[model samples]
Target: MGEPFYITTAISYPNGKPHIGHAYEAIAADVIARFQRAMGRDVRFQTGTDEHGLKMMQKARDLGITPKQLCDGMSSYFIAMCDNLDVSYDVFIRTTEERHHTASQELWRRLEANGDLYLDRYEGWYSVRDEAFYDESELVAGEGGDKLSPQGTPVEWTVEESWFFRLSKYAEPLLKLYAEQPDFIQPDGRRNEVLRFVEGGLRDLSVSRTSFDWGVKVPGSDGHVMYVWVDALTNYITGLGFPDETGDFANYWPANIHLIGKDIVRFHTVYWPAILMSAGLALPRQVFGHGFLLNRGQKESKSLGNVTDPLELAERFGVDPLRYFLMREVAFGQDGSYSPEAIVTRCNAELANSYGNLVQRVLSMIFKNMDGTLETFSSAEADDVLLATVFAACRDELPREFAAMNFSGGIDAWMRGVFACNAYVDEQAPWTLRKTDPDRMRAVLLTLFMAIRDLTIAIAPVVPTSASKVLDQLGIPADERSYAALTGADWYMARVATGEKLGAPVPAFPRLELPEDAA
Candidate 1:
């Protein structure tokens, strides 16, 4: 056990089936959680479907199904997506659950008791597509001269009796929060965007809706359901067993980070923090707004007919390969595009050719040339240098970059270590040395064996399945695969003491071929 670490992905609104964007957020959050665990943190990761809102209600009506039926069916797909993608979430929360309703109502009562809530009327531009309300100033003109939200979603004017939260009162406090804790909202660009939005001034937000009842009911108020954002944001605490304010809630109430898409930054960073403040709860440590995943340079959409099913991609290319490609191709805070060709090329070049081939070759030589035996060997300056390079990448560079959420940059550093190993193998030519100088050949192969273990452990958080296969073949114990084990000087001697020998190796990441029709 280690210090408690809590991370969450934005609850996906399940008005539709899971999309690439949903998979992207879920996978990225899982990577963070896995990485934290590898770094010796006791991590709690939560993700789920936000099943209540006007969108879900209207979508259910259009499909002629009950809202609960729609949520039950649609949320299953998201759960499947997370499972299929190997997202190791600890909790999967559904807002429709009775416990979540209780948690949300208690949060509402706290806000009311703080004198921040009041009955009011809301008449403004709202985007059901975005599940957000916008001021008239935030609207942009569409091609047809219609008003659109900043996200370009169509907005509709609505008037309803509602309950409002005193968001206007939190502007100064929030600005102070941002100024004092610069990392409170991640990616300097997103923080600056929020700074500008808050500087302009905050408005009291409608916290309850009277139009329809597809949300948590406002306590002691009839015909008023808590606003969808209010309910949705509460899911983070609800998963921790809030309102009870004990056990997990007391331990993890202030989430380490809320990993969400950029479109929802205002809600998480602005609205979410204010609500928590009013309730006298600790604010989350950070809110990270990650950029979208695009389909070959264009945003995927139904109208464009370019929507991709992430599971299909995972099936085409192996799951580990797809996972590797995403973290390698995308800069964490910036938009990145992907295609069938991109997936095949990136995975084959990096996972298969670089790291995977390194593992296969090193282990194969140990099985053949070294008689599958383990022994202590002397290392030359070159072997020492190669091991140093790999160790630094695994221990120093990757961990530092990952701590700052720089996935691609960390992978880049790891690749340099891989490149160094390949160059070492080519220079050493252990195959030729096997006939001429058997002892040096044994040393070379064994040195590579050491390097392989470190590399595999460092990357396991990203591609867990394939990494595990390689580790299993290497005879590394399951419990010793974490980053903490990377520096153990006695692990090799301990293994040698066991007289464990290598078996013939299998390719952990076989090369992927693009389908003929994929183009």
Candidate 2:
């Protein structure tokens, strides 16, 4: 708790409306950030728009407006998406911000002072879609013999005077870093890909582009803008008040984690670290490249007309279910498909039936049988041994999974307890016990309520809205809602007071119905 935890999502390229892909990244990062904060850490979570790029410049021209105006409108859409998804980011940065300009120039000066940067005539294939330069070999020939970047973006041959970073000299250093840290990059597959890339051969990187003027200006260089990647990546440090070299920088610099999409792993794991080393700064602790969200089993693309708007999805099916499906359907580091059907199936079965049903049913029993009051069993242990075991498993395993970045694993572990709670309710049949042995029924219903309370708290990060609703239905006090307040206090911080009547029962996750079109 004493140490600071800094986490960030790669800034979105605000050239268009944000899609479900953007929401996926933001929600994943938010889940972890919320969990760390709930654990009592000083957490700084940042996400923003990468407004300085050739794509944005071209998009602005197409719309017949200044790039800043275009970015201003588009960035608002992204911010709205984050808000709609309940993403808990503390800082939102725009690369066009004045602070970013100073930070980019300062970072450049540091690289220059370290002798890692120099002016050079650059010739390469560049992808405006990617805002990255590619080597000749990295371009693939299409059936029509047109060259495309490795990720299938169209490339153009370009030549200009540019400032270059001596990235070639850092290949060996990066290898040593991978060897020593072993976790500098993540998902094992992505780390190996980066290793193979730097092993294949490292080359000098162009740091400033003379051909573009809609970006951060290159210090002391006329008519030049710093490369979009360089400016965009520095937002991580700029958000921490870098160049000032004190305060947030002194505490939160050297980000604990950079959560990014896999397509940009090379930039974060290789190029970013080399830039940091050149500046005589600490590299981020981890770079995790998570997978993309697919639509109808294919990558979402504008041409395909299948790009799903995140806000629209939230409007149709509420926020917590969408957030839950984003994590629950996908393994943290692998591609996963999204559809209305999948979302409905998961929500109806897991949220509505298992977890949601458990909360409403347990509380309903306590209210109907004990007049909304509860009393703890006097035993040193729970009467239902199996339910106790499941609670213990969730109590011990959910935190461990979150720490390892296995978000799906954490959800699974929490759901395991949820299912167990439901099973205990059915098998014990507290309703029948109420008539036969009313006092024993009180103990059983209270135990079930406690399990519901703890399990809901365990999953609050992933499905925040529903979890909060569940706690409110249980009348959990506000101060005891955080993970620390619950798990930190004696007796695991009981929330349902002894003989205190809970409020009227309300459905947490209402059952969803299939769209008429789906039928």
Candidate 3:
């Protein structure tokens, strides 16, 4: 086992089906988790649906279904999305689960014990769509003089008896935390935004709601349920078995990162850390608020009729190609757009034509010319230079960029390695060597064989299925496919000793055509 690396996605609110935005966040988090494991870390990845909130209750009423029934049916769609898209999440928690309720109440009890909770009356702007309370200063005037939350969701004035957390008391402490740990909130823009918000001032946060009972009950308070954010945020610790304060809670308590959308940055970075501090727990190492995925150039919405169902997109395009296009096309921590033409052009040129063709041509030639027998061969200066270039990209550049969460940049480095191998194939002209100098040809082919292995392993985290197919043809064992395997010296010779013959190669990433409707 390696050092623990725990990461989570903002649990999806189940008022609607899974969208492209949800899929984008889950895929990014999964890539990070896989990348960490490849770097020799024990990783825990969690994602699920946030099932309790006032919006859910109203939606259930409109459907004439019980809230649990609505949640049960809706959350399954999210689970299926994860399964279909190959999101390797370890836990899929729902706030309706009994364990989650227990964890939420336990957190409340801890806050109460710390004197952070107090009875109060809340009369302010509440956004049902966002499940958030907003201050008068934060509301914006919409078309026709309607008051809206900063997110542009309609706001309603609500009056209720509530319990508030003394968030004001921790404003200075949170500021000090940001100062001491400059990387506590990521991407400088988000961190600076939070800094400005906190510098403006803080107010006591309403932690319990008296208007609805669709949430975790307030401990010993007969008629109130917790604010949805409190219950939803607690899902992070709930998955780790908190309150017991032992086992996983003891080991992975303070998560490495909470990957969330920019729309809810305040909830995760500001409110979450404050809540953790009030409960006397260590804060998460970082909160990263990532940008949205747009359809073409505009944000998707029901009114726009541009909402994309991610599963449908996955079905239209192969999963690996879709995954590749996302990490390759999008600049991490910033907004990116995708359309059918973009997906086809990017995947076809890069995955199908460039890297995939390199794998197919190299392996097919080895099978046809060398009788599929891999053997030790003498290398020339060109062979050494090619290997060194590929090695630097895989072992040094890609890992460095990925560790900093610059995913597009890391893939760019990996593509450079791929391009180098293709260029080597052209320069060596191994086919000509087969007729003129068979021994030199064998050496050239073997050098390419080694370079292909490194490229495959470096990229497996992003496109796992296609990489596995390539590795299978290369006779690389499952256990030896991690990044750690790239540096080991004896694997190739050991494989040659096995006398395993390479099989006929298949196209791992066949070129895709654009759908007619999308065209």
Q: Is candidate 2 or candidate 3 better by TM-score?
A: 3
Candidate 3 error regions (>4 Å): none
Candidate 1 — what's its lDDT?
0.93
- For model 3, where is the 10-residue window of minimal lDDT? 244-253
For model 2, the stretches where C-alpha displacement exceeds 4 angstroms are 379-387, 485-499
The CA lDDT of each predicted structure is 0.93, 0.86, 0.94
Cα misplacement distance, residue 204 of candidate 1 (Å)? 0.5
Candidate 1 root-mean-square deviation in Å: 0.8
**Full-model lDDT, candidate 2:** 0.86
> What is the lDDT, from 0 to 100, of the residue 479 in candidate 2?
62
Best by lDDT: 3
TM-score of 3: 0.99
Q: How do these models rank on lDDT, best leading?
A: 3, 1, 2
lDDT of 3: 0.94
lDDT of 1 by residue, 1-519 (tens): 899999999999888888999988888999899999999999999999898889999999999999999999999999999999999999999999999999999999999999999897899999999989999999999999999999999999999998999999999999999999999999999999999999999999998888899999988999999999999999999998888889998887689999999989999999999999999999999999999999999999999999999999899898898888899999998899999999999999999999999999999999987779989998899999999999999999998999999999999999999999999999999999989999999899999999999998999888999999999999999999989998788999998899988999999999899899998
TM-score of 1: 0.99
* Clash-forming residue pairs, model 1: none
